[model samples]
Target chain A: MIRYSRRAVLKASAAFAGASTFAIPSIVHGESDRIRVGHLTPLTGFLGALGTYATLGMKLAVEEINQAGGIMGRQLDVMSEDSVNPATAATKAQRMLEQDGATVLLGEINSASALTVMQVAARNKKLFMQTGARSDALRGKNCNKYTFHTDIPNTVMVNAVGQSLLRDNMVKDKKFYTLTADYIFGHDLLAAAKRFFGANQGNLIGDELIATDVTDFSPYLLKIRQAKPDVVCSNLAGNQVTTLIKQYSEFGLPYPIVGFNLNTADAWAAGDGNLSGTWPTVWYHTLDVPASKAFVAGFLKKYGKPPENHAWIEYVAFKMMAQAMTDTKSTDTDKLIAYFEKETEFDILKARKAHFRAWDHQLMQEAYPFTVRPKGQANDQWDFIALGTAVPKAGEPLEQLAPTQEQNPCSL
Target chain B: MQFGFLLEQVVNGLVLGGYYLLISLGLSLIFSVGGIVNLAHGAFYALGAYGCVEITKYLGFGPAVVLSPIAVALLGILFERFILRRFYTADPILSLLVTFGLAMVAEQAIRIVWGAAPLSASIPPAFRGSVFLGDFLFSRYRLLILAVVAAVLLGVWLLLHKTSFGCVVRAGIQKPDMVAALGIRLQPYMTSIVMLGVGMAALGGAFFAPITIVHPAMGAEIITVAFVVVVIGGLGSFWGVVIAALLVGVVRGITIHFAPAAGEASIYVLMFLVLLVRPRGLLGERIEKFE
Candidate 1:
């Protein structure tokens, strides 16, 4: 007798249901007067903490916009879904488009999920403002007309951090040992960092690709000891940061450390004041900019803690999309895309003005390099990172932070 | 690699193998003695780790380490009594499904209580430094882990080989009807053994917590690897589990030194090779109940 697996049965049924539903026009379930924004982020997996903050950030933005008379005199309506994985993300994106009547789609933390969401957005001809997936490929080889990324790509992050490190005399003549997460994001980040290091005449002594679910870093730590590199660059993500930093400090390997991108949530998880080294982020709650100060105060008064980098990006992405729609007075995908590409000059909660680069629809915003606050200098538990270098010193001029035209030639 | 560095890698392998030994031992016991497939043993492990982290905040580290495993063991006792006991005489697949659901519940419960972000416990001040052993630097905490695991393994061996409880358990594994005919209450013995197995898993969690991050999904990560080890060590053999855990751990350690990318995949490769050679495992015993 042949037995079918539960997953296969469910997939078959979902395909049948989806095909049938696609034939019918979407019925708007939300308030007819409100403009619906479908917010899809990983709200329940390993990235759940960041995703929760992302949801809160978007909620705060929507409320502020609605209170201030939302775009084109319509209140913003949000339909949130947990983008669990790529397959589920694609399914949910289709559901949002065909059943929920979401006029705009945004918010995805995983790059793979964001790619799938981008595909759905392009297929439906809806405006998608991607919040936080750092793969440069989204703006490069996979560039689509309907999707716009508001987060810094991996190439930008690596270049920004690398330039800052070099200017600080940190990696000019030093040997570096790197432990990278073994996946698409990690591979992209490592490649970008290698390019930056190669340009700066730095030596890469050893590099190891670590598994995503690795709980032990001792083997890699031992190898680090033997290599005796002057600096250690960890290109790992999520809880890998916590495990590696804690174990690194415990092992007492005396090397200055840095990260390509480190989330503030991970810094908090590395409690007992174990968070060390310099890191770069698109935004942080402790930034000294006026807009950042306002966001931090508002988020703190409402949510009881400052917003993380992910939260900051989500908040900025929604506000940018909303402001663009208001300026153009149209929610048409072509109008929004043309408005952003040709005439959109927006405040990105930074000191300088940022705009969507025409070549690639990436939000060319300033990146912040932060150092872990010393134990005595920290004012509170979350005040763990402070600015390492002034803005625009390393991450500026849209052309410098991102890849050159020769490297990322796009036809859009 | 230099001799000293290679030796350090071996030591690392031993520490990792000791951990796999404790976790796989619990999986092996639940399958062998109770004839129940427990997929949630790793959840108990996570509970033990998170319990230790929370307890350390109120009590000191020593008391936290001691009480965490006991708390998890009590939870195991309750779980075995209420949920697992119902499926004891039922189809084994029922137990697998029940435990798998329990695992999901435990993971979500942990998320609600502890939050989804990964949390870590710092090493005790006493175990902070490294031991300089003539050209090699070994972490003192890892050495302590190795010693603690060795003692636990030795104690377990003595319990299984040199006691009347061991005889009853061994006899029950092969001939539960004979043990029942001899006027012994097998149900209580089975419950007690289940508690012991789960407690060992918790103990491993408590010890390994300082070295690793304590997250809700950490248990799920280890459970799959533990199941692989159990399968490769034979379904219900005690010695088979011990040997397989160490072998897998050392091989993984060496593989990381050579090819870091293949380190995780190498465990499955080893499992495949072992199954090809000995379908029942390295020290698999012929158990008529499972057949």
Candidate 2:
């Protein structure tokens, strides 16, 4: 599946990038002495804890690669900085690449922050193997050849779960109420839910978006309790997810809740069976197979805690970068990208086999549909067993949802 | 959407009002007597939450109880003489600014020392369930919180109105020259009053810490609502502030039920409307102008 003509793609100004032909620097073209990978994440603010966990995962991945004879004897020299804001991420991207000599940069959990870093990647000619952002626009129209997504995009995750429900007969004419965290992520996830539901047989009765900084959900829950839908879809993470599900259960809304992002293993860790029986669309989980189990076990053995879906993405990014480096047998940025596109079936952190789409640069991997179990049968972060479902090839010639890079100029 | 929704919103508003009342009472008391707003009041609340979390986390205490407020008050005394005494005679606004900076410094300090993330506080293991109302359910913890707040308010009122020290402080606020002429050193009393007010804020913070995260900006965010209560209640009028706190909370709560978008906005509207009604506020005493 790894096809390469090596013809240079058209280049645009900094105001726009239309899949430019990458010019490899003469220095690291054939040599494999050492490759520096840069990373940026928010280690402060409300989302700091999640950011730290993601950062630690990247560091651990770097360590594993270094231990195993390095990337062709050139270890990943880690250079990380805190992208606390758009301005900060932009600055860090410069320092990591320009000053620190990072060949490829990875790690940004926040999608808004990732778009900011994308500008830096375009300017510096470095590959940003985006690890944890889920915005759908990162691929397709907004996508650049220099940009390779490691995180599962929302459209991909939604489509996987949507199709699964259709095949499994889970998508019946069920009424849904959404308690979305009010933001771009929340809005897009809810919209996808509505689209998928419309595509399938599911019906959306009501939806509400909660502000990001809202400390309490009791007031909002009051309205939800009154409406009482069959299903409640939520888009929230970290402690907010923990607090909401706990309060939702307390309100005793007879509704069965299913959230795309909320029903992760991290939710269970923060909350004790608060989200049991909820189904979520996830990139990878341990329950699917042996690689996932080993990854989770290795993570727990080292970190002394279970690897949530976020951690799996970090592990995968590490493996992907290592694979691209191995196949090209060179550390040049352009050659590495060519090697990535040519990468047919690579070893991901979780599943034994994963394929990346040549058209969209989207990784075709398995998504999980987990049914949360009650208190008695809980296993660490997981509620119930997870079922494996395959995501379709990413670059479908269907209707494009997000404005592509050519349409939306990020620099301005 | 329904009549029940409005009814439920009112209930929700009351809960918010009650919480604000607890937080603002301390702020108002300190401002009238201490001549400072005590911005660090939110920190006390956060610390109270952290205390409860720590006690429960390490010691496995049932839940962080109202006893946290008492600890916060004592902590306030240490902060008072060292910090408040230095700025007693300065401009009132200067003191306010100082305290505001202190609040920021205190919050960051707390975050640096304790780590910036939300901490967990349980509904006292005993009262963790919910009580059914007509259509909605209310947690026993919230009811217990309201009850504790009431008791603290009563205790603060009793101490302020009943004690001779309270009389002297009240007299000093009314006529500082007379109190000073009578040979009472205002420094000790002013310092103690500042301590008392800060302690109350800390207590409020500690109680709320469980409900919210112990983040650095938390103090600044809630302070707006607390300030609104202070402004609408009339500066230096204790009861007026109390009533104002309740009114704002209820307004915010009900707004959530109905509009949800204008939860904080409705509070400002209520304040403007109240200012338009009675120039000094409902319970504010008229002052004789002095040059």
- Per-residue lDDT tens digits for candidate 2, residues A50-150, read 66667667877888999998888877877777788767887889877875678888888777777778878878888888877776666644667777776
Off by over 4 Å in 1: A1-32, A44-46, A67-69, A394-399, B1-3
Error of 2 at B42 (Å): 2.8
Leading candidate by lDDT: 1
Q: Which pairs of residues collide in candidate 1?
A: none
| Alpha-carbon DockQ of candidate 1 | 0.53
Structure candidate 2, residue pairs in collision: A2-A342, A141-A404, A141-A405, A142-A404, A277-A372, B44-B202, B45-B205, B45-B206, B48-B206, B49-B206
Model 1: lDDT equals 0.83
Question: Candidate 1's residue-wise lDDT over A1-412, tens digit each?
Answer: 2356899989999999999876645446436777888899987655666787788899899989999999999988888989998889989998887777788899998778899999999999998899888877888888898999888899888877777787788877789999998766788889888888888888899999987778878888988888889999999876788888888877878788889977778777777656677788888776778988999899989988788888888888889989888988988788989998894788878877789988788887788777777777878777768776544554436556778778885666
The C-alpha lDDT values of all candidates are 0.83, 0.67
- In terms of TM-score, the best-performing candidate is 1
TM-score of chain A of each: 0.90, 0.80
